[model samples]
Target chain A: MSKLLIEDKEVVIPGQILAEGMDYLPSNGAIREGDNIISTSMGVVSLSGRLIKIIPLTKRYVPQIGDVVVGFVKDLTYSSWFIDIGYSNDAVLSMKDATSDFIERGADLTQYFSHGDYMVAKIANVTKTKAVDITMREPGLKKLYGGKIIEVNPARVPRIIGKQGSMIKIIKDSTGCMITVGQNGIIWLKGPDLKNELIATEAIMRINECSYTQGLTEQTEAFLKERTGGKQHGVHQEA
Target chain B: MAYTKRLDGRKLDELRKVEAKVGVIKTAAGSAMFRMGNTIAYAAVRGPREVFPRSMAKPDTAVLRCYYDMMAFSGAGERVRPGPSRRSKEISMVTAKALEPVLDLTEFPKSGIDVFIELIQTDAGTRCAGICAAALALADAGFSMKDMVCAVAMGVIDGTVVADLDKAEEDYDKGPVADLAMAMLPRSGEVTLMQMDGEASQEHIIEAVELMKKSIKKIYEVQKKALLEKYGGVKDE
Candidate 1:
């Protein structure tokens, strides 16, 4: 007989049995082993219809195509600039994808994107060997200037963004920071002053920590309200 | 004369008191500390990040590197010399092999997962303790693992099979001392590592394996509790 071994939203570690028998299917952080479906990572169990999946608590960033990422320029070659996007493999941003400007052959690529410069780009392609290629040809995608970056656990990014971007909107409106959250968990915040930016950074970090708890949106709103002195403080300042 | 009683006044099949904690190191990707009796081991796991000496990285799978070291004051009888020694090198290799079976690293190809284990105290079963701590840290890091690895040192003293020998038991001079360290996958009861020193009879070796399996179940409970405690998974009884 088919049996459900665990309840939904229950935290399970690797090798913990989620279900027994062939009635259930395993996916994403879970796997089938013989007659039982077992979790392959430390995560929360999610039971959807006949499918069993695990939502991982913590994991490194695995780059995917079309993911907006904030990265730093690490090296410059004649035709491309290498960016470190917190992935194991450095992402390559070639000349044509780097900008809309026409360029001569073997031109100095550093002029367009210099080392230590932070930029927001989207992944264009990833090879079978995990070689990543990023692009900046899209709108709102370009080098970021004078904003500090902070990283959170990549798995918690979805919660930070929240449903319909409401959670991030609360933080942005209160701190008055121009926040750009990359899918890889690297976040950039530029505020009217360093103090405002630091407050926003702290808020985001707090959200990242309590992402798994219930009533997160309300908790975040309360936190932002207190930090901004119960009002939108930097709305008048230039971002 | 027969070794009817344990040196520490414990049952013959009993194990040392085990204490386990996870996320002990703030900077490591995953870190854990495991203590069994007087032997304590701290393990930290880093990466699926870049692998140095790029040539050594495997294209199809991540390299699992383990470094096992004993601190200068960790040794029971004498102060351990700092740095890699012949014994430590061998232990490191074995520890890696013991943990390799449970880890699935194909998704992180061309990278490295480095596990650094330091023994802050020692009585016996140092390698086994290190393996247990490393397994917990790997789980804390959210790596894909088939099962947890639990280990213990089983030995024969004066023809009596014993589980979890401490320094005094290991140094028992009344009879031939046989020290056998084993690492097993708790679920399947598959032996991933089994190293023996000294000598034991065929019957005693078989009995030791059975006792090791039973002892492993207890260690597995501690490991599960440690990982779950970190994420607040434990429910009130």
Candidate 2:
């Protein structure tokens, strides 16, 4: 195994052997001199023994091709809608990419999409200039309506949605709000009362803040009960 | 009448609540989030990459490119779209200039430094906050630099020079509102970045600059403390 430097700092980026005789290996961002492993990166270093890595304290959202994301309509043309996807530029959603069905010309474009409307889309392509072209022609991608929208840090959206949609499923089961999250930081929620909408919003915000914690489902359930003055219905009670 | 009144009940020379956190982004070379009261800015610095647009490359120094953006929701009621507007471009250019003086650019010949700052929340004084956060992130990224750059904004409000103005004070100040933003090299006392907006008498401008110098000194101390805490008092030269 060979040792290398990250940014000129002595760090053992996975697959580097620090010692010749011992099974113990230095973690990522760590220096192994003798039996001890020293941190070479400026972050909370984690060690799996298999390979140590540096876990960054902050998060940033980077768009990827073929990933489904929610976006907000900012500008409209006769043929397409310009969507703001929290990137350096707006992504285009041509009418052809909106749906496989043919859309009639001058048919009250608002019927298909109005400015400020949020929808789920897939990144079709990214140009050399980094301009992203998006399409709604896929399963589970469509226009969103009749829900109050809230914005959060784009980087935290995945955590807010939770693993395999478990976290969001809980929120939906509890608050009974038809919810949709766009990758661009727009969240849409529709509930019967202003109270339920506010409750759902608070739950999402809390999830965003406390994403690092374990037992998030239980914690969120308890939090919702305390805030709403009653236990949430349909909470998955695991035996 | 209280001699010190600039809304938010802060004194003429008193600063707003200042908070700084390091390592906000996992993918960036280095990152930081800074909040001056309600004005919150996040900065990420990634660098030592091959210079783009080969024509702009210089053999002697690293080219620094900065992008400053305000989140559409940063304002009170208006939602801003993410993109480079004229205002954002101007702020980005000024922020890049502020960081240029402290960086030992000669180290990375034909390379580039990319500093991206996003204003997650804004009340006022965003440009100064962006510069401060970007400088810290660059240091965190392990880039060699001459000194930490600390920035602070002072403004002439109601004929009195106030340090760090918030949104209400910035909007309502009746007198010739002059905003002076400066970035200083703590050890050298060198002004790396300086800019003033609105008209102020030369005397008032000088007074504002003096106030900024003092404020930036305090900011420098904060930067040092944060870095020391992260690296265990190991000074990076």
Candidate 3:
């Protein structure tokens, strides 16, 4: 059986056996070996060995074609709005790709999208010369307002969201706040009181800090209770 | 105008406080974080990986690739977007060239070296800061080089040439302010990379170069001091 290191993490390629007699894999603090296999790139592994595969992380946010993200309108031109997607160049949101609703000519663009107004968008195209175009026509894509935004390392976004939305659901339920996480590392939290908003922010921060751990839902729930002087209410208990 | 004073109330040739640390990231093969005045930069050097793209790969020497990025939160006022801009791309290219003469790329045949510089906070002269930080990181990663390339920026403002320009001083646009940034081999007194912007007379340019020479001398001392502190003064030849 052939085994190789993918990104410095030991992984058994599909149709290959993880080296025998090797159970404990070195932890680089990102991923651990012997973790249950979830998805495979190609074929399934036949032999059992504790091997962990690592995913490369990046600090800059590059817009891949067809990636759904949320961004803020930084500048408005005659035909498009320059969207700040936390990338080097702002993504272009053309009028054709805007909402279906009618937009007036020469009207104050702020009425449609003021500066700092957030909107969920999809990367439609990226040119070879580094022009990025975005669209807001997809379902559940709209402008975001009246929320407290928190930023974190974009690489930890998937970990903060958790599997099947369980972690975010818990935070929303416990704090009674509406939370929306943009894939580009922008998190919006809106609640009645500043206290709940702070709690939600702290919870998200905690998730970002300890993303590798299991049983994070229970840990987050307990953390919320400790921070809020007891359960506030509307916290859903998973069956 | 030749103002006989420093912007930070120090002497004309006084440099801002400089601090450097190595091995900041355990994951990276070599890493360093450095601060000059208010500017902060971090550098990580990785690889001896097989060259890619086939065409750019060198049979006799290892290729060097550099990525210099400025964090959005590094500057005050409006935050910048992450990733490389045109200016940063130019800086990265120049920095790679600055170290090219020093590195013994022949040792790693058909391989490449990657230097990644992240500007955490920028005041002024981030390129120089990045070069200094990258050199330390390269050394920390056990890469052999002839001599460390030290860089510094000097500028002429208000008829007076300053050794190091701060943010405010750099932004002053009233006069024909010119900036001269250079990377030099301290021991050999060889120029590795040099660039000048704005308008300056030949005399002013020569004066700025002299100032940069002095500033780089001090910077070289600091660089050696930092390495000695980290590696116990081994003084790798």
TM-scores of the candidates are 0.96, 0.51, 0.49
Residue B49's lDDT in candidate 3: 59
Candidate 1 residue-wise lDDT, B1-237, digit = tens: 999999889999999999999999978888999999999999999887889899989998899999999999998768799679999999999999999999998877898999999999999999999999999999987788989999999999999999999999999998999999999998889999999999999999999999999999999999999988887688878
lDDT of 2 by residue, B1-237 (tens): 322566677767888888887778966767888888898889998755556688886766678999999988898778987789888899899899888876655545566779999998988899989998998787677554545778888887657788987888777634557677777766556887778877778888888878877887677766656654544343357
Residue-wise lDDT of candidate 1 within A1-239, one digit each (tens)?
Answer: 99999999998989888899999999999989999998988889988999999998877778999999999999988888999998777999988899989998878777899999999999999989899999999987979999799988788898898899888888888888888889998998888788788888988988876677889899888987787787775464232
Best lDDT goes to which candidate?
1
**Residue A179 lDDT in model 1?**
85
Stretches off by above 4 angstroms in model 2 are: A1-60, A104-108, A213-215, A229-239, B1-94, B100-130, B133-221, B224-237
Chain B TM-score of all predictions, in order?
0.98, 0.92, 0.94
Model number 1 iRMSD: 1.1
Better of 1 and 3 by DockQ: 1
Q: What is the alpha-carbon lDDT of model 2 when measured against the actual structure?
A: 0.71
- Residue pairs with colliding backbones in model 2 are A28-A52, A58-B24, A58-B25, A70-A182, A70-A183, B72-B80
Query: DockQ of every model listed?
Result: 0.72, 0.05, 0.03
Instruction: Order candidates by lDDT, high to low.
Output: 1, 2, 3
lDDT of 3 by residue, A122-151 (tens): 899987545689988887677877777776
Descending-TM-score candidate ranking: 1, 2, 3
